[model samples]
Target: MNPVHDHRRLGRELDLFDTDPLMGAGLPYWLPDGAVVRHVLEEYVREVERAAGYRHVYSPVLGKRELYEISGHWDHYSDDMFPPMRLGGGEGEEVVLRPSLCPHHALIYRSRSHSYRELPLRIAELGGMYRSELSGVLGGLTRVRSIQLNDAHIFCTLEQVVEEARAALGLIRRAYDDLGIRASRYRLSLPGDGDGKYVPEPELWRRATALLEEVLDGVEYESVEGEAAFYGPKIDVQITDPAGRESTLSTVQIDFHQPERFDLHYIGPDGGKHRPVMVHRSIIGSVERLVAHLVEAHGGAFPVWLAPVQLVVLPVGDGQEERAHDVVRRAEARGVRAELSGPGHGTLGARVRAARLVPYQAVIGEREADAGCAAVRLRDGRRPGAVPVDELLERIGARDSDRGTELWAAA
Candidate 1:
């Protein structure tokens, strides 16, 4: 019913990911081809987060309602959350599907008294979170009830806040650039009086917003008024799809109020207890939405780095099938996702056209195979003729590592 639905249709035609009535909607079943890309992207995010000085932590999918209440999320996030359940008899009788990974991480921090030296502690989680989305608004992976969020939270001292926020913004831009979505613009939202995601103290929220805005000032961003979460102000990155549709592809929100609400604090240099600021950010806000946006932006032809299948080796005849198998084996050995085009049968043109709907790199054939090469083709409609197998692999791998959209300079 929505243009987003049209995007979903393209996803199916390309064999990316899908949803169905049997699964009762909002539950996306990523096909094998789609999973490969999603899995790689998820891992890539994790690697970057770790390199950026964040520690990885795993937590439960469900938490007590009291937890949410204490964090202010229960009051604010209840409607969008899955229904709560009564825990027969627990320390605090409240259980709901985690809408976000913050409160849980905070609880982990409280597990032990933290000192000021550990003030700017960053925790990242690649989690599958569930929420209750109205069925009418659900469309494939874009707006789903169950989704994976590339979520991370940073608890830092006042002094470290600015640099931390700056680092997050950099990561956002780098990720987009890697995915070939560089033309996107970013928006920075600051808190107003009685506004921002509620910081327990007015001055704190005000000061935090100012600090973040100061760091973002030199950076190019469109400034917006009062669009931040109730707990803090934020920076959101958005891009336009082929039809000129704007979507917020990623976000980095800084929170000061929630941590204090949950009694989150660390011993400071003065040996006095002080509140730690919490930052809720997702470089890739929602993986499902990101995938959908990428699908539409590139019209379902992902780049080599992001493509599920990098190459499709097609044999000219049954005799060449052995060579094709060897070529495919070599490609896969080099971390390329390659497959034969229907074994001994199928026209190479038809297969290329079909695979074109997907993002693929090369197609090995009789001539190329005999010559120890593959017919290298770019998703951008360029046939670079037969390239040595090793050359093709190196080109594809290097482009992927460099986040280049194409094998040649234009890509």
Candidate 2:
């Protein structure tokens, strides 16, 4: 049940995800199926974030070295970032690849001003983030030096902090439940009182931490010390795969500190300029890492909605190839990602075996072509059933809405 190893092997076996040390460790390639699976997740995140009032924004991949300096990453994680280089001529300024989605997002907020009514502003970005993760620590898609973050930043007034946190936690829960992954733990991460340098504002830390704790009351969680973000306490969800490996998939972080460092402010109803509290979050944290998790969690038999090929239409003989092709077109036209498989040089038995490898196989032949029906054999074979194209389309539509369900449709 080593998910890391399981995905590493399953990815290659399914011709989905790939990694090569020569190209540098931690950077994995998403083959056709892997890419499709990831695309589905990305689309899902985009829809959810948009509905949550998150405005999408794009920024440069590289930023001035001073950006990291102002964000304090230079001192905390400088070594974990790409080396900086001078841009333009030698006398020009230096720039480094952005390792996280925050510093740039902070700049986005700093780029504008707003009133108290607009205090709870959310900005989302599905952009690639770069980090200099040690090659030794690299593993398939689970750990990557370069990854895409389905990230968002929330800005709200002090009074709205708890509500904001609650909304974020709910979002994470929705994603976990939809994906069929067990909700391992949704906890309030607070710094230990023992940590000497934890904000000198003990009252602020106490009130903030307690607010988060109160929100989790009656909710499931087990607190852990020293796991809170250095900037603020947070609500984080950790997922435990079937193999028992734990990973943090999403978080709603309370940052009472970064806003000040970045000098972010908003106009209050009192006609006074007030600093807004900022919360950083990522529901699909790192898309690459989450894809890796899903690969192992479902053992490469992706749910119909997330499966790269929802159905592979196979011709029973050379004579039925065109009919199989027609079935493929019909499926794809219905917005189902499907393909046609041939008997090839192998016997019909071999072709059927290969077809089973796909999540769903449509065996089209005299029976299927004449009746205009498909033998929709599921990958696991636990649920074998025939579904007309329209029926399958209806099933696909039902799975598209993730609310309170897993990302991959239930088998």
Candidate 3:
């Protein structure tokens, strides 16, 4: 990885985010620019999940310790979890910050009974979760104590597992395609033979592993014997960064244990109750990690749709202030994230140089103002000349709408 494009450095240079030692390590403070990028990403993923028939919900970040105990996390994964906080003068139950959202989603699914017709119940949440990470390993947004996951659980019958898994895989593929990222390889993480980290149900493990293998039958994947979660087997989508360093960005996990542990059931068509298999999936994985990846992937120069500032309007002289403001207004009306740089802000040269931080810059001057246009300057040193205001707005609108990665890729 290029250290120059390291997210920690670019985050500071771009005024995107920061971390404070006063607030403890691994906690990020998102500045306005960074918040804009995060909001855009969250909304985009929300729409994607909505289109996929997923019901989004909000859940508390902390839950009673017994909840995780029933979900099997307390027995197998408590070290990574925050210590329990006792409430009510030591008379009440102990609560701990949840390490994941799957158990909470299982509770939501059990809140009401369902019929066999509603076999595939996809519940999603962009939920914030807290985990206890070692101070030595915490660096930038990639590894953090607090994480917001693009997590979802699909509760379906045994017969629907393959189809639901395929649908989940399709979502991951589509998301990666849109972001212009490719996975290096698929990894089927399974339980180790004698590792105490995994649950000890031979038959259940075998069935779940076989089901995942069948679902990914024709797909190419490497079997990772001891990397599975304590609850079940998972397919990890491993992405290789520009520097050739590989990391897991997404996952589709087959969980047969959580449902049974939580006693989640649905009424079958045969008038009998049956346990629904749970498929835990994440499209972009951790939102924070994805942001870090994108920042480094694009070197802090985000695309038109995801960029904090898509276009900067720079006034050549004080005389063009009114015209510059007018251009910003028009661009904003056209759904462009445009800003104006006036005389008092800096010199003309400095303003132009600052505009390099954004994708496109329009230098408005007396000549262009009189002609009802602005001189468009792209970051790649290409000048599209003084284009009409209407045409400029149209170009920007098209790029923003289409989520174009480069301003002049087509040109």
lDDT of 3 at 9: 84
User: All candidates' TM-scores?
Assistant: 0.90, 0.91, 0.96
Which residue segments of model 1 deviate by more than 4 Å?
Answer: 1-5, 88-92, 190-201, 343-345, 357-367, 409-411
Q: How many clashes in each candidate?
A: 7, 7, 0
Q: To one decimal, what is the Cα RMSD in angstroms of model 3 from the true structure?
A: 1.6
Q: Give each model's whole-structure lDDT.
A: 0.77, 0.77, 0.89
Error of 1 at 162 (Å): 0.8
Off by over 4 Å in 3: 406-411
Cα error of candidate 3 at position 33, Å? 0.7
Ranking, lDDT, top scorer first: 3, 1, 2
Location of the lowest summed lDDT over 10 successive residues in candidate 3: 402-411
Q: How well is each residue in 98-174 modelled by candidate 3, as lDDT tens digits? A: 99999999999999999989879999999999989999989888889999999999999999998999888999998
Evaluated at residue 172, the lDDT of candidate 1 is: 87
Q: Candidate 1, residue 9: CA error in Å?
A: 1.1
> For residues 39-106, could you state the per-residue lDDT of candidate 2 as single tens digits?
88988889888898889999888999998888767766677789999978899999999988788888
